[model samples]
Target chain A: MELLLTNLAHGFGVALSLQNISFALLGALIGTAIGVLPGIGPVATISLLLPITFGLPATTAIIMLAGIFYGAQYGGSTTAILLNLPGEVSSVVTTLEGYKMARNGRAGAALATAAIGSFFAGSVATVLVAASGPLLTQVALSFGPADYFSLMLLGLIIASVLAQGSVIKAIGMVVFGVALGLVGTDVQTGQQRFTFGIPELSDGIGFVPVAMGMFGIAEIILNLERPEARSVLTTKVGSLFLTREEFKRATPAVLRGTLVGSFLGILPGGGASLAAFGSYMMERKISKGRHLFGTGAIEGVAGPEAANNAAAQTSFIPLLTLGIPSNAVMALMVGALIIQGIQPGPRMVEAQPDLFWGLIASMWVGNLMLLVINLPLIGMWVALLKVPYKYLYPSILVFCSIGVYSLNNNVFDVYMTVLFAVFGYMCSKLKLEAAPLLIGFVLGPMMEEHLRRAMLLSRGDWGVFIQRPISATLLGIGAVALLAMALPNLRKGKEKAMAE
Target chain B: MRINHRDVVAGLFLVLLATIGLFLNMDHNLGTARRMGPGYMPWMVFLLQAGLGALVIFVSFGKRGERVEVVKPEGIDIVRIVSVLMFATAAGTLYLTQYGGVRADKVVTFTIMAGAIAAGAIALWIRSPETDGTMAAWTQGEFVAFVAAMVAGVLAWYFIRGAGGYFSQGYNAVGIGMLVGFLVLAIPPGWRYLGLICACMCIFGLFLEKLGFYLALIGTILLACLAERDHIRKPLGVLGLTAFLLVLCWFVFIRELDIRVNLWPT
Candidate 1:
């Protein structure tokens, strides 16, 4: 406890510096603004800024980037509430109740609940990082090729379950993503795998190009096509704040989301996006008034918002301790640290206590800053609905392209982004949730890399996935997810009668 | 309108690509009898893609041609979007390649490229009266603001931290202080542009090593021009010309050449 307090104090000292604070504010403001724009997400934003962050000190850079990651979650809810457009995939749950609340003139309540819930979650997750640092570090250090592979397999299965859709489609997309990941040069053998003889392909398809294309650019194109369909709520803005009753209802959801998300976010292959969706679904399942769902339940806004923020904060635990990125954004953070000549692992805490502690402490400060900026700006953000959609949509596309191109100084990425933008739009049109596809994309490469590594280590023994304790545990969880998915079908008869 | 045709087409493309890929993988002599070869992964990827492609097609287009309902853009709207994108790409390329010192056999490569793109876009907008194209009218202010931005970008490059002649190591104490001052005072419309400038600065050192001193300067401008232009055909044209020049130079040095031809337009 003394060590925790001392570390927290030192962290405050570093984070409270005027410069660091200013950077945090800047990151939050920028992150929130971009996040409010549907389809331009944190991954594209971070990839764009990765090269620029190389010039800053490691801790300051991470503080700013991490701030953007969580701040976007806060901002994503704003769009969901007002426009019925979930800016981030995880924020889709927010759309069910958030937009309904807006239509019912409870927009302010929804916004407030989301913001406060996020803050609460972020605060708790920060503590988790501080407390669980050592144990997570042990998990990080002991991971071998086999362990890593099994963990990723578990992650893939969990991600598929997290994607609320046909399990087969999720599996298909995961396999597809793994195939795409194999396009680059083979690691062990110095031979190009799927270049199609294009000089650029020899290095394989770059992640930024594919990600930006599929998610960022695709989102813009889809938005433009549906400009007429978007119904913006211009009804009464309500109290412009969360009422006492609203607070009482939201507190429990926020706490539950925080706990669930923080724990899940710490696990490898888990991210804030997945945690957010998981929390939102859990909230719906537990809510007394299930019929009120999808029409703007306060719990919907509160739970997912909390989960997303907490997951964003707790995601750093694995990275700070184990050097494993829970998602692409976290991967970008690892890239930033590597550029700063800092290898993230168990010894990082011992070697650079100030950096670790300072980052953790700064997350709270950033959350506070976000709330300060967001609460009052809620009105302004809603008023933005008045703007003409034609202008709004184009700028979104431009920003997405700019963000993608900023990654590698390569125009090829922009072209790829355009391709993905169309694909994403098509997916949306088909009622195929892009979230599952993304989950697959994010986990596919990690799964393959680990799988190959494991195979090499175990000399082709497939049982390696179930041999280790941690791996076995993770696999067990995966099996349970699969079983749970099937349980609904088995109980279908009883469930129908109960419903009637 | 019904089934998601876009998905069907995308899935079909994937299947076709996978088939071709599978054939190529079989042709590669990547491994021997003792060890797994590099072709192994490619073949695995091919099969996986083919399988997934088939599944996506079945899910999306099966069940008696049942279609997935989707929102779609009109033909004209798509054209407008494509045009705007083309303009942005062209502008970015021109700005990066022309002034950023990317070497090429041409002068004012960025300006020419941007003009071509802007001209085409303006023409397209004018042709489509029904389309709002957003802007009420192309005003002097917009033009002046654009010119100023371009000039400012070039100046930023000139005074960048690592451009040398101004600051040691391109960004020593004085350079960083100046950069901060510039940022505070100028505040470029987009921070990404500023980031790009920093990139231009950092890559300056590498350019020095790759290209001879004189050529590096030229190459920087060429690259900057390409960065500003949308599609890179023009810059590639310049690069092609340069390659020709290099080949000629080789001929003169080793094979002896009496023929004289300056393929570069500039």
Candidate 2:
């Protein structure tokens, strides 16, 4: 314990240095600015800024990148709350309740809850990282291909079953989303599946166009179609403060979210992506304010916000301990580290204690900086909603188009966005939820990869899913959920699914 | 007879999509369960899709068509096409091996090719006299905007023909661009607001490299702003917002981020 404290103190010393703090602050500022754009998410900002980090010292570079990652994520949730635009998968859950809160004039409360929840989760996750990095790495490395496949399968099932409509239609949407995701070059075979001979689609459809189209552009069309809905985004701004009751409700959810996120985030592949969705499902099931879920519940925002934040912090575990990049952002960190002549792994702790512990401490520092930066900025973000819809939509369209076009500098993506927007608008009229489709889209490709690899490993044994302990447990839970969903009389589980 | 219009339409749409999926997917190998090929998962998913869609249609039969659009009796031909296509393709994809003297992949491919052509012929012969208003969904202003978008896209395509990627596909991107414009007619609210923004994006995409960021921004913003009637009420606010947005974007995206875009026309 004393050694842990000493290491953490040394980390804080490195992170708090004058040079490091400025860079960290610069990263946060840039991340927030870009991330607040309609379609620019953290990954895009990080990749764009990655070249700039080449010149910095190894530890300082990692610190700034971490700062940018957190800042961009916070900015993402801000727009997801205020503008109903989720730039990525993690923030999609935030939109379900956060946008509703904004609609209910509680945008302030939702923003505060997210900022505070994220901070709390970050702090706890930082401590957890410092204390048991190696131990958790062992648990994470235990997961095999089957385990990952089963985990993602359970994720898709829960995402669809917990969606806010008929389970059948949601399943159809999920299935279709998977099909859309398959519309690129096959990773294993190098043969294209559904690209229809378009070379621009070899990398698959960019997620930004699909997400922004389905959420932001479609939203503008919907709001305009309603004659009385003009300027609905400019509803009365409520107090930025969470009420005592709200705080009391959010506290437990935050704690639970931190725990959920920390554990899930340690796993590789798409584990961190599941953090917010898992927490959202849990909140929908048993949070004290579960009844208020569809009406902008504070618990919904608090839990998922905390969970994703915690996941973001703990995802560094694989990179720091196992020399594995958990996601694209961490892979970039690995690249930065490789460029700096410092190899990441078990040796990293002993050989480069400054880099390891410093990165850990800076996660907490970055969270603190995000709170300081964003709390003052929430009022301004909500102020954006005050602009009349007529002027605002046009500006948003420009930013969104620019962001989408910038992905590959191809206009084909702009066309994809237009197509999805029309489809999304149709979905709204048809009573089909877009969330499950999105979840399926994000997870489908990963699940296919893992499932194929797992099948190859087990030589086509259908029993392999239940044969492994981890996958067995995951599939067990999924089976129970599916069975409950299937039995109409089972109001016990539908109590929450029906509420959504 | 009254029918549950929403469920029936949604169900038919899903089945149509699955049939298309099966056709496109049949060209790939469907290896056994243990050693799956690229087509295996898609074939299974498309089958599940057809089944789910059929279930939705079957379930809708239990409900009174409450305030729903009644299906014209003559349009039963379209329904027949949907159901037969669904069953035939799903069965062909699954039981491809049972067909003698053909490889599994070839069997599935031949079945889909044969089935799609047959279905097309049937649909043409049994032309349902329903609304058929997908083309009529376009208004004059929207049509003008779409044509302008197409002009911009085609001009850009011709000028940039030396480039690779979608250009190598011979105006496939332009066709894709037009597809989105037409898709506005496929859905609800009749393409007024959605089509305008979509057309604005198309124009922006076509001109951003050549005309530069500022001009494209102004052009697209102007097109999008026309979606609102009240924007003409306060043209100055619109103008000021456009000007302010240009400066803000220049500072934010260009100067601060060093995004690779020319601010002025080259």
Candidate 3:
């Protein structure tokens, strides 16, 4: 405890530095801007900015970039709340009540709750990061490939069951995502599997292109097809800042989301996004005002936004401790560190304690920065709705394209983004939830890796997944989730089969 | 009396692609000790995808006479979309031409892309206010403004890097130059240069200089502009200005306190 406090104090001192604060503020501002622009998500934004971090100290660079990551989530909510256009998977839930809130003239409250909830969650989660980093490392060490696979399976099943819509459709999307994830080079072998002789196919499909295309571009296309019923915000923009009653309602949800996000964020695949979705689902389940869920439920906006930010913040744990990137943003952070000649793993904390601790502390500062940036901007973001559409959609496309291209400096990604956007538009029209597909896409590669790794280690023993206790527990959870999903269908099927 | 063509097309495409994938991967191996072969996973995925495709196809065909409500696409919008595509393709071709001896900087490249896309959006906006309007404006104006501001901000950032000599002096020169450049390029020449002032204020704010005055000035201009338009009778303009100021202040005191800021350039 003494060591932790000392480290935190030292971190705070670093984060409080004038230079670091500036970077954090810049990151938050840029992040929010990117978030507001549909299709340009944090992953692409972070990747684009990765090169700039080469000049700063590791801690400052990370703090700034991290600000952008979570800030984008906050920004994304603006679009979702006002326009019903979610920039990324985590923001999908935000679109539910967020847009409705705008329609109901509660855009201010929705934006406020999200901003405050994210701040609360971020602050609380920072404490958790300080307190639980070591403990979570211990838990993470216990997870092997089988355990991880089972955990991902559980995540998939839970997400499917908890999603709003037909369970069958969710499952189908999840299955499709998983299958699509298999399109890259075979991990077990050195040979290309699904590449139709396209040189790019040899490396397999990258998630960035597919994700950007489906969620970002496809959304633009679909929006273009139909006249938007309203602007991003509705009603004459009022003070949309949270009222006292809203604060009271949102505070608990923020706390809950923070707790849920911190723990889940430690896991490697789709942690932040999944936590966001899960938090919203849980919030809906527990809320007394369930009917208000799909229509301007403040908790709906708060929980997911808070959870995503918290998860994005806490996800640094695995990357910092184990040198494993659970998501694309963390992966970019790893690249940034490598460019700065810093190695990522356990020794980083000891060798570069200042850098690590500074980063963690700066997260607190960054959260404050985001709140400061976003709170007053609530009305401004709401006003974005009044901007003539002629100038709006094109700018979104440009940002999305630029952001996507900057990810790898590859035009192929831009093409892929367009393709995915078309796919996403189609999915939205078909009522196919893209979240499951996104989760599946992230988990697919890891699943193959784990499967291959387990197979290799066991020398062909398929029972490894069952034999490991942690793995078995995760599988158990997956089984439970699957059973939960199947039970209703089975009940319905019994009568149908009887009728047949 | 109809089946969803979109679903049918998607299903068929999925099935076709997966089949081709499986056939191509029929013999690959990953060098695993167990020799599960690289093709193993791909085959599994292909089969699963094929199965799902079949399932979707079955549903599409099984539910005969079901009226599918799809968002309709007008012929003109499709033409506009194609034009955007043509423009993007042309831009790419021009970019390639630049590689083939045509000179282009990052600024030029970005400007061209932004301009082309904006022009396409404007054309669409004039034709379709309901469907393509909001998105068009967002893409062309606001997003472009944000990008240009960011680019200018980045240039100013370079100026802030040095303290006095070539590094420091050059920093200020470039920073000022960037702001001025944006003021000229981004601001509309029309509204008594109201857009130009906003661009300048944004640039000043980015440089951590005395930005409050410009913020106020921009606010006043915006307010005047809004006031002139009777139909756009909302205090949102004022509210937005205030928000901008508030955000600027927050960035100053909280984020960049070390910088000496006068709040008025002149």
Candidate 4:
């Protein structure tokens, strides 16, 4: 505990630097702005901004990116409350009671509760991350190649299982992404696999283009296909303070949500959306006013909002300690870390303590900054929604094109982006989830490397995976997950949960 | 005879891609599973994809599955979309060859010209009054107009081939072909607007180095604005917004960040 506190104190020293603080503030502002814009989530925004962060120090870059993430979580609830639009999937539950609260003229109270709950969750989760990061790192250090392979396999399977579509289709997307990842020159044999004689692809497909194409440009085309109505409540926002009764009702819910979120966020493939949804379900079951869940209950907003923010903060635990990305957003963060020449893994804690702990400390600062920024800036964000999407979409397109082009300064990347955009559009049309594809793409090469190493180390014994206890257990879990997905009743339960 | 299932079509596409990938890597050594060669993983992946594709197809045939409703477009709409795609492809090919160090020769130019003519012919055929059940006389007039537009496109291509260092002959031919075809066929206003915007984006990518940042951005934004329904009614406002955005981009990307992009053509 003393050591952890000392580490956190050192981290606060790094995070409180003027430059780091500025980066955090910038990330929070940008995150909030993008979060307020319906359909443009933090994943796309982070990918869009990834190229710009290439020049910053790794610690500062990650601090900014992390800020954007949780800041967007906070900003997402604003739209949910005011416009009944969940800007991010994690905020979808917020709309259930948040929009109702708005209708009942408790919009200010709902917003405040979310902000305070998120702040509380963020602080607690930051401490949890700091305290548990080293423990997880130590656990990760004991893992072998076979164990790592099985764990990644389990993560990929869980990701596909949790995808919002047919499990089979999601699996196919994952396989397709893995195939795409195998494009460049083979590492061991110096031979190009699928370059098709294109020298540009010898380095493999650029992640920026693929990500921006799938999430950014494809979203534009999808949005264009459906005309959206922006129906925002224009009434005066009431007091930002919650009533004493409301505060009393919300505090316990927030604490419960933080616990639920913190626990789930550490598990592979459990992220903000799952945590938020799970917290809401838990709240509905436990709250005395459960009947008022869908009828302007402040606890409804408080629980999910806190859970999502906490989960968003704690989701970094796996990525930071194990080098395993639990979700698509973490997958992108891994990409960012790789670009900074920092190989994220168990060694990350000891090798780069400042980067790891500084990022953790910045989350608290970012949450505090969000609370300070969002309350006063709420009206500004609402006015931003009034901007016509017609104007917004074109600029977004131009920026995306520019951003992709600027990566490697090659127009071929831009063309690749267009191709992915078309493919992404087709996937959306088919109701295929793109998230698993991204996770697969990011983890595929690493998984292959680990698997090959394990095979080589075991002298080509296929039983090596089963012989190891951890690997065996992880594979067993993966097998059960696949079996559950194949079973219709469990699949229905999953879909029901997803729908909620 | 009638294959209406979208899943089946998607599966078939995936199956075809896997087959092609497998066929292309047939010669590569697939070493033992222990010491996998370059092709081993790809072969495994392709086979898995093919199996998944088969499963997708099988599921599509299930009794209680959701059927995807495919919206078939009108012939004219198909013609317009195909023409745009063809033009974009031609431009992309030319850009790839010229800038990306691909071999650009007579065959490449010929292929581009052939593609342009095919796109133009499709546009003319789809726009023919006979296809729409109009009078035969009008159909004849449309055919004449199509021929005249083709001739004009060819003449423009011939005249502009040696005019400037900025424009390639292949790009000139494709551009003239697309413009003439669009004018002769008189594409629906909405589609035309979208086509122009897409074309501008392509142009921006193709000429960002040659045309520079400000000019390309202004032109792209201007064309993008045209896609809006109210752009025709508020042209000045759109133009003003374009100017304002160009300035903002210049200050942010160029001046503030020193992004290394030239403001004007070198």
Against the true structure, what is each candidate's TM-score? 0.65, 0.67, 0.60, 0.85
Best candidate, lDDT:
4
What local lDDT does model 1 show for residue B8?
51
Fnat of the models, one by one?
0.13, 0.52, 0.22, 0.37
By lDDT, the better pick of 1 and 4 is: 4
Model 2: DockQ score: 0.33
For each candidate, report its DockQ versus the true two-chain complex. Answer: 0.07, 0.33, 0.11, 0.27
User: Among these predicted structures, which one has the highest DockQ?
Assistant: 2
- The candidate, 1 or 3, that scores higher on DockQ is 3
Each model's lDDT comes to 0.60, 0.72, 0.61, 0.76
Candidate closer to the true structure by DockQ (higher is better), 2 or 4: 2
- Model 3, B35-84: lDDT tens digits are 56766666676687788667665666554312243323223446556756
Steric clash count of candidate 4? 0
Off by over 4 Å in 3: A9-20, A37-62, A76-114, A156-207, A229-359, A376-385, A400-413, A419-439, A489-500, B1-13, B30-33, B55-266
Give the true-structure RMSD of model 4: 6.6
TM-score (C-alpha, index-matched) for candidate 3: 0.60
Clashes of 2: 0
Model 3 residue A12 CA deviation in Å: 4.0
lDDT of 1 by residue, A1-500 (tens): 88778988999999999878888888887688767755556775665444445446888888888778766777777877777777766677778788899888898788888888888888888888888886676666688766766666665666665554445445555656666666667776767765644566676566655555555545444444344555655666677677777777778889889988898887655777678777877888896545678777788888888998888888888778866566656766765676577877677988988788889899999999888899987666556545544334333333343344444544445445544544454444333445445545544555555666676677767687788877887778888876875565633432332222
Model 2, stretches more than 4 Å misplaced? A1-118, A125-136, A227-363, A374-382, A489-500, B1-5, B60-189, B262-266
lDDT tens digits by residue: candidate 4, A325-427: 9998999999889878899899998899899889989989999999999988888877776667767777777777677777777766766776587567657
lDDT by residue for model 2 (A12-54), tens: 9988999888888988877776666555567656655554565
Clashing pairs in 4: none
Q: Is the docking of candidate 3 incorrect, acceptable, medium or high quality?
A: incorrect
Model 3 per-residue lDDT tens digits across residues A1-500: 99889989999998889999888888888778766765556665665445445457778888888888877777777787777877766787788887788788887778778887888888988887777766655576667766766766666676665554445455567777776777766654456655544566666676566655565545544544444433443354457557787777777788788888887887655467778877887889896556678768778888888898888878888777766566656756765676567867656777887888888898898888888878776666555535654334433443344344444544445545544653565466445677667667656766677777777787888788889998888788767656764565553543342221
lDDT of 4 by residue, B1-266 (tens): 32225555456555655665676567578887688787887888789888987887677767433333422222344554465456546554654556456564443344444445443434333222222123111243454454554455455555566677645623444444444433443334312432343344555565577678887787767766756667669888787778778887777577755676667887
